[model samples]
Target: MAAKSATKSVEQGRNLRPFYANHTPEQLKEALRRMWLVRRFEEMAEESYIRGLTHGTMHLSIGQEASAVGICLELTDKDYITSTHRGHGHCIGKGAEVKYMFAEFFGKEEGYCRGRGGSMHIADPATGNLGANGIVGGGLPLATGAALAIKKRGSKDVAVCFFGDGANNEGAFHESLNIAAVWKLPVIYVCENNQYGMSVSTERSTAVKDVATRAAAYNMPGVIVDGNSIADVNEAMTAAMERARNGEGPTLIECKTYRTRGHSRSDRNRYRSKEEIESWKGKDPIPAFEDELMALGILTQADVEGVRAGVEKDIQDGFDFATKGTNPEPSSLLRGVYTTGDAA
Candidate 1:
């Protein structure tokens, strides 16, 4: 299997096409920029938390940039997405502005959630990001429902659900997939298997060797891709989106990836070895993608450096916006707590 994969890689390199053949150079560059943004946003979020600028805990997707950007590359603002707790990347990939995201993190009223929902719950309706859930496997049913709604409305739009490996064992995962398959719902289930679920390794928790294999029971296509490779992820998502648009039910995609950071702010890095972390860092999605682009002559070193510089400015600007933004008023605490008007 390893030899076959090597051979395929060699062939792909020889044939090298832009991630999506039709994608323009600018679009490809934008994808790279988004990946960098996701990484930088998380880094800044962590720095802010350490500096006592933010109070609540947050999950970071620093090493998993390719999975988020690649999956969303094929989706438009009209398409929907349900994100997990570690969804900063998803928000950025779906086109949420970093300034608003930073504001939300800083608990400013100018946030996407009016400063109520912090890192784990940012939602932008304009971008079709239904919301990021704090509960485990929370987005599964939500995406399923969104896909059902799309079907009922007779629309070609599909809903993508991003969940972690831990969520795979949740009842919602099985229930949602079953219903989506039975009704031919246009939902794509993306499992970002970052090796460990919080601290527990999948080898110890999951019965199946690969999470995608579980989709077979639902009679849908199950695909596994190297989540570190943006092109690999984009190709898989493109196919899944195509299938969904063709009225061909839901598809399950498992991104074999790793997260370089600890699960949350409180984690002490006790469970995993330093060697494992270092190994994954070597496969860091941003540099890997940049290398691919350079190899293909899609971008020069100066172009890559320019993108990084632009991202640095964006991150700094977002930080400034968040810090200068107004805080949520204590007087309006109950504003969005309860639905006003006729409850009936």
Candidate 2:
């Protein structure tokens, strides 16, 4: 009789290596950790909203972690990024402090906007995060202007604008792209194609199969990437960044991803079918990347768990900081609105 094996089957466990093979060990570890943080942070924001801890409407990026992290990884700290309303992932990727983000949502003194602009308006100018906008297609022009500034200053810095598929349908998208292309501005237009613009799917919204295809109109190269694959997204982003820095002008990258959560906290997401949501959920980026990394021998079960734990701790610390921080003074609220007073 043959003896039965005692070891656990690899099939029973997670494997996430291939997507991380191009990454150094530290980069792979940080990637895993950042994804975990983004997920956890979204959950926290959702919970806070439900508990009435956060003010204003909340938009959670539950399944769009890869697109944010992968693209932002290609940018330097000095580079700028304009984000959309559902931009927690982008804010985090661009190195915004989780604590300040939490404070921003809580409307506390420690918030990025000094308790003025809630979830959708989070920004850290010091980190080159211009701001996340409430209006669709609003940030596009701002990004173009920033690129112009970089050009005028003769700086190697680039500006990346993150927007939804809905924004592409706007005139600002077209106008900004045209001007940026004509001027050869250093900018990257990243369309986080979550297949939905609010409640409308891309099929119902746009006639084009790929949003990147529109880049051709402006004489720029447009590329489509599997937003679900962090590795591919990162590679595409790196190429785009290189093109921008070399003064070759902007590249339009449409990352085909899906958002599992509703458009906002009030949304029931009844517009989409359950089967559709399930289908997209199956292609979720985190687990998909885990499988790829394990295959490439870059991650093991323990590694994933450790990274998750670290993220949890950071999230908890952020919450603690937000809660412990003092609220801003009522009179001080009027300050910094228009001008800074001179001490003299």
Question: Which of the numbered candidates is closest to the native, going by highest lDDT?
Answer: 1
Candidate 1, after superposition: displacement of residue 246 in Å? 0.5
Residue-wise C-alpha lDDT for candidate 2, range 256-332, written one tens digit per residue = 99899889977887899889888888988998877766766667888888888888899999998997877878868
> Across residues 1-344, which tens digit of lDDT does each residue of candidate 1 receive?
00012222323434655363546556778899999999999999999999999998999998999999998987888899999999999999999999999999999998999899999899998879998999999999999999999999999999999999999999999999999999999999999999888899999999999999999999999999999998898889888988998999999999999999999998888989999999999999899889988887778999999999999999999999999999877877777767774222
Range of the 10 consecutive residues with the lowest summed lDDT in candidate 2: 1-10
Q: Each model's number of backbone clashes?
A: 0, 11
Report the Cα lDDT for residue 37, model 1.
94
lDDT, residue 112, candidate 1: 91
lDDT of 1 at 239: 88
